[model samples]
Target: MTERILKPGSTLGVLGGGQLGMMFTEAARRMGYGVAVWDPDADAPAHRIATHSFIAPFSDVNVRDRFARIADAVTLEWENVPAELCEWLERGCPMRPSGAVLRVIQDRIEQKQFLSSRHLSVPAFSIVESALQLRSAVDRLGLPAVCKTARSGYDGKGQWVLRDASDVKQVEHILRTANAGRRWILEQFVEYVRELSVLVVRGGNGAQCVYPVVENRHERGILRETLVPASIPLDVAETATEISKQVVTALQGVGVFCVELFQTTNGSLLINEIAPRPHNSGHYTLNVCTVSQFEQQVRATCGLPLGETRLLSPAVMVNLIGEEVQAVTSGEGLYALHATAGAVLHLYGKRIMRPGRKMGHVTFTASQVETATETARQFIARIRRSS
Candidate 1:
């Protein structure tokens, strides 16, 4: 049976309207598709540009019906958007990644278990439903482990690093005071050589395209920068790409998915976590790739042929978090940023700024990876000093 293709001018529905959704909307519009953005937050950046905007809660049946009626297909910007909502939306329009996939990936424990059950390499982990269970899990995993909420946490929130007994006690108290039945996962802390990520786009027909593995650096659990064509051996990059493709294929996922991996000192790769949508690490794709990840998301969601993933140039992507955006908004910092060659700036158009919030990003592209890396490093350092 031939799959239906949503031709250009078709309205594509997107759940969650953050920066990723905003970028997706932009891409879809550029490709001659109209986007319907459904996010409860009216201030969501995507809503500002969407052809149709729904500010109602996901549970509202009226909004759901209307959105389903207008959209030819649907995709998500964030994993945390209720899986039930995706299931409901699936009845009227195709969900790029079915709700079942979202249910498994949205929870930390389930995601890890699913990958491990599939014979994939993942960090050692144990589930914790209570303080006592947490203690036991820590004992089994040993000290210097990490504990994170099983659901609904990102950008370093709802996570704790247990370097000692005191840190464990602090987390235990927080768990004890929390509502009942809350679950968390304790993972063995890995001594990794570097963090890496790859973006895979799978069409509804099961055709897949894998992007180059990129190196990522995080500060306080937030992604700070990404280096394209990760500074790793060819074999390691191939292995990482293979593992990422294996993961999305196992889940039967359609759309753009980013697989984060840990390259251990032993030269083995361990699955860190997966993002159902385009990832921050892949932001470099916009500047250097033949087809940006956002465009791939649009094509995959509409059942169109997946775009080429060829890299046009070596690049580096640096995120502007919170007040760091002020550096590029005006003054000598702004002039300096614009003065630099091969630097592209992208601001998320977020009106409010708070600590730890992602505000914008800068992608530096150059003929050589070393040039891009150095330019990005100097830019980052200048922003930090100004901030």
Candidate 2:
């Protein structure tokens, strides 16, 4: 089949201005494509580097039209860019991954139901409104469950883990956690040994590509590290890849799609979440693989074939949140991070250093995942020292 053109010098419009968008802009720039992004934050990471930035609400049709006029095509850094805005813009220009896919993923309830409809196994979950409904859901799903806001939750924010009925009393606090115009979703906790992620890139012509599985680690509910070529059995790893493909076909999605799953002791995999962008888990690909997720995102959105997903060596990626960076109090602490072997530090140009805000990341590759992991861990001590 003949392919469409996504030649160099093409201008791409991105919808959000977070780090993912920043990285995407960097990749596009490297490939000789001009990038433009629309975000409200003047200091947003992506906006800092974009060739053109419209500092306005994504919901504004005029901004969308302006982006359409300036850019050859449209894409987004994250999934929550109000598909309505994309839909409104699509009438003016092409937007990748389709509004259909975005609509299902924008809401957690719809995302979970879409997975279930495709015969994918996800954690036991219930959607609740009132506190009484939450208590009833907990009663059915059991204690020790997690309640996550159905929309606008990410980076371990907007979640509550309840050990028992007493947790129901905190519903008001949970409700207030999300910005207005969102609701909470309750999910039964799964006893899993590890969390894994797979990223798939589908071209405009329906051509597809896949990346290797990555195991993720979390601290205090926030993602802390990701290890490439996960230690799971080969069969399990392949299974994860297959499950990810299932999600891709189910969503009828094009461009990079991320599937987060939990692997149980009984050799089962269950869906955890989905992200239709350059994901945090795929950060290791920047150095470990021949093609990084950011590159793949642009390639797929531009209707090009996917690239290699091979790993040259074991790799680990560490997230540097604002809270963690602020805790680094001295020059010595900052120097330690720069000194780590094989470390590639990517700092988002976000001006705010608020607690729990994702600031940047460090990645390293080695022949040994465990040793690489330990080396990455040593930075925590330095962080503590600086704090």
The root-mean-square deviation over C-alpha atoms between each candidate and the true structure, in angstroms, is 0.8, 2.1
Q: Which lDDT tens digits does candidate 2 get at residues 1-387?
A: 755767888898888888888999999999999999888888888887899989987767777667889877788888888887777767866687678889998888999998998899999899976555777888888888999888877877778888755676776556646365566789998899999999888777777788888899998777889988788889998889999998998887878899999998787999999888889888888888889989988887666678878788888898887667654334665676666677777778778898777787878777899888777777655564555
TM-score of each: 0.99, 0.94
Score each candidate by Cα lDDT.
0.94, 0.82
The prediction achieving the highest TM-score against the true structure is 1
Highest-scoring model, lDDT: 1
Report the lDDT tens digits of candidate 1 across residue range 81-175.
88998998898889988899999999999999999999999999999999989899998999899999999999899999999999999999999
Ten-residue segment with the worst summed lDDT in candidate 1? 1-10
